[model samples]
Target chain A: MRLISLTAIAAITAFPLFAHADDRIEDALEARHGYMTMLAINMGTLAGMAKGEIEYDEAAASTAGANIEALGNYAVSDLFIEGTANGEVDDSDALPAIWENPDDFVQKFADLGEAAAGAGEAVKGGQANVGPVVQKLGGTCKVCHDDYRKKD
Target chain B: MAEDQARRVRIWDPALRAFHWLLALLVVANWLLGKFGPNIMTLHFWLGYSIVALLAFRLIWGIIGPESARFSSLFHHPRSVTGYLRDMVKREPSHWPGHNPLGALAVIAMLLVLIWQVGTGLIADPEDFVNVGPLANKVGSDIATKADAWHALGADLILIFVLMHIAAILFYRIWKNEDLIRPMLTGWKWVRRR
Candidate 1:
């Protein structure tokens, strides 16, 4: 009877740790999702203007570019903590390959930051400059997404 | 007498040849860009537009092009397709200057699937509401979602069909001693007079 009580106590104590870890993972996933969504929103605006699908409004482009550039400056490594890779969380598009090749994955983020900076500068120069810079910026996203993100 | 011994025929016209190779190149390049080139949707959109244009040309050409390139000349009845398959199993396949029955089916299938693929792309919206197709905004969110799903599924189907098409060409080359690819490249094939 004493042994049974001890086992029950251990189970009760261990449960919270698991729950806490899960909660942290969920938070991380939510943070990353918001980060990507913001990036996409900014990207879409720039892309629409670049393609002539929308009228080129310099103010809007500059604002979007600054947003992206700022977001790029974020320390994204913290946003993708342990247990955020695929299979660990629901709706995570991150592949295990990101963890497997940490250096390359991190390098892609660095590239994205650089490209975002270029985009910010290009937007100030107006339409012609924005297209190529946005292309470069998008390419960085593809680089990370192709290798590190899971396809749906 | 020596020249008469091997009769060579021009089966594929220059326009058809150019269309075939250009389409192949564009498809491969666009796929790479789609898979690996992010934010380069400008180029991606242009590539897709080119593909749609080429497909449109091909469709019209298939209707009114040369004798060998016409759909009426290539498409065969189901019985003929089944018969060709049976003969292929026996290692005694028939020959045509243009696509054979089975090859014809593959060509038609690929063209139709690609048309569907490009059509879906015209209305697809990636990332909820961002980076959408040109016509995506005109359609509602539900339709956009359906188009996106079909676009994703269509990409895989295209890959499968392309691989199978390559495998079939290789199979014919090794097993039946046919040079299907060579004819496509050179637009000429040696035909035996009956």
Candidate 2:
């Protein structure tokens, strides 16, 4: 009877740890999605003008480039915490290869930050300048996703 | 003369030989560019279109081609394929006027797989919204994602089939002492007089 009670107590305490871990993953993914959404919105602005879908406005181009450059430098380690890859979290598109090859994954993001910084400086000139910058920045996305992200 | 029992005959059409070498060069280029040269995506895109064109041409030509080049020439009875395999295991070779059974399998399988690779590649979207297939805009995001996965898988399948093909060619060269590649190159092979 005493052993049974002890086991119950241990289970009760450990349950919270599991729950906390789950919440941490959930929290990280939520933050990641929010961050990604912000990134897409800013990237969209630059891409639109670059593609001539939206008429080029110098002010909009400047703001979007600055935002992307800043977000590229944002500390993303928390969001990519181990055990938060796609198989572990159903909704996450982060592949296990990301955690396995952590350095390469992180370096890709760093490369993006560097390109974004250059792009931020370059787009200040005009729409013609924006097109080439967008192309350079866009190449980074495909290359990084080629290794780290799940299909799609 | 003993040599006159069989003679080199023009069998594979000039069109077929051209298709064979051109597709081979383009496929190798496409694989290299697609795998290693991500920065040169325009070249990759153009090569991919060329491959699609070759496949489209092959599909029609497979029907109306010469007797040796026609798809009908590739069809062996099921028992014949197995019998050929049984003989192959015993280190014996049977000369077919056109493709040997295993060669036929390799050719048809490669065609289907390459066709599938281009089909999916045409519609896939990686979702960065910047890098996408030419036809990506025609499909919903969900469908595009599905095709993207298939496209990736198709790349792997192509590699496997190509390796298998090379292995088969080597097997013929080293084990069977058959110069299967020569016919494709020169559009002629030594065959028994019909």
Candidate 3:
């Protein structure tokens, strides 16, 4: 009778855990994906100005830089919760390496924020400064993507 | 007296050794700047230019430097490379004053691939046209895009070659009891008496 009661309790707890797991994983995946998409859009604006393809409007560049900096400073760890890696969450491009090497992943994310802040400062310095900072910022994105994000 | 005379032989010249280490340092530093250093693209560009200049010097040195440093002295025919591998498998003693046949191939391969890497970098641009190469503006956007693709591909290839180079050095050290790294650093290798 004791064993039966214990088994009944285990089933009751395990079922709810399994039922909610998928929802939580999907929510985290969508949050991170949306965040990255926003970053890419702002990055595109800075890139255009840097390339001389778009006229160097100081205000526009500053706005884009600020946007990127704000996005980079977001609480990224909460968005990349456990079990949201590539196979675990549908539509997630995050590699399992991010979870396996959490400390390195966190460090790389911190680097992105720092680079973004530098880029924001560079935007006020005109074309020569903005161009290189944009490049440097892109490099930080590559560093994280290379190790933590899954390839298409 | 004979044993003492053969105890050490000059292999890599000072110029060659300097070139090897300086190039290695620049490559690693430039890679780090790209990956981690924001607001430092100016330094990255200067580093790339320096690498190009060093490579130019190496080319001329390969022609006129000491015999051991010359390409003609280092290169081997395919059959000779195969024979060297066979000898290696048989554990026969082979003491090359400079690079062995296989090492020669790696050196040449690295040089050629690096040439490709820098060449593409000269004409490429980062995404959305940011941080373009010096010559990128002169080329059409289509051509620059192509160069960008090749530049990325070349970077990966360089990484593979560098890893292979290190692994080979470690293998020689551990398996063949040859201290290849020390000779490169000191510009001298111990040769057995003939």
Candidate 4:
């Protein structure tokens, strides 16, 4: 009975993301940008705390880190819908390389999701501990962008 | 001293020579850092800043440094530049105490292109919003994008100018038996005194 109730709660929480997993979602370019912006915001908060630009607050760190973990694992395929790459659409920074090398693109996020999960947990430690993990999370953001994002 | 050794003149000064080699090393190192190790932003930015410092010194040196390092030495009249090019094609090695006319043009182009490269780098950013240059936040994202394009183009231009510069040195070394590289190091080149 207890295990069944725990599974039901987990399913209820995850159902929303799964429901919106439509591959042909509209305004995907904007959607993806919005998603990335959110990640960046949370990332900026953690980065600020890590760089001591913002005072270290444990609760804030934990929230931002967990937010990154959840966002990183969110279904990304729909957000990268076909024909939304730069030049194909207006103001798109999404490089054609993303579509050309879809496997590598998919793999990068998969790895980032895993890394974000670890970073999310590692950052739960006090002030001194968050810096390195924040850097690691930033690296995950960079490695993919370094390859897949439009440079200019 | 040997007859040819006696012909050696103090054309390049010590400061200019050191500046040449140090700038060369730093440019190569920084270029490699940009091309191969984009992830190494801290080191790359630090080296670039070092290049900017060296360039600043060079600018002052060009103004008031030795005759060899002066801006006056670099700008040959149009006729002289054309004549220099004409002589080179005829395999006539016209020797100057400082940069030869063709080399001077190459130097000017190189310095300009390098300046553009580093200048654009100040505001350059990938659209991905990575933690980047000092002026990344100062400019709008569109401007940063434009600068990034120029930055990449500038890098290629730098490489081409650098290659041409080296090729010119090698051409002099083998064909004309002129050791341009050594003078940059030793501050003296064996040239006809009269």
Better of 2 and 4 by TM-score: 2
TM-score of 1: 0.75
Candidate 1 per-residue lDDT, tens place, B68-185, comes to 8899977798998998788785553234558778889999999988999899899886542234688887897668757876886888888888899989977878887677777788
**Ten consecutive residues with minimal summed lDDT in candidate 3 chain B?**
B88-97
The Cα error of candidate 2 at residue B139, in Å, is: 1.6
Best by TM-score: 2
Q: B5-53 in candidate 3: lDDT tens per residue?
A: 5367888889899999999999888777765665436687789899999
The predicted structure with the larger lDDT, 1 or 4, is 1
* CA RMSD of all predictions: 4.9, 3.0, 8.3, 11.1
Tell me the number of clashing residue pairs for each predicted model: 2, 0, 0, 0
Which residue runs does candidate 1 get wrong by more than 4 Å?
A1-15, A48-61, A118-122, A125-133, B1-18, B29-45, B65-77, B89-93, B120-133, B136-163, B170-174, B181-194
Each candidate's TM vs. the true structure? 0.75, 0.88, 0.60, 0.83
Over all chains combined, what TM-score does candidate 4 have? 0.83
Query: DockQ, in order, for the candidates?
Result: 0.16, 0.49, 0.10, 0.22
Model 1, residue B100: distance off in Å is: 2.4
iRMSD for every model: 4.9, 2.4, 4.9, 3.2
Point to the candidate with the largest DockQ.
2
TM-score of chain A of each: 0.88, 0.88, 0.83, 0.80
Q: How many steric overlaps does candidate 4 have?
A: 0
Task: Tell how far residue A128 is off in model 4, in angstroms.
Answer: 3.5
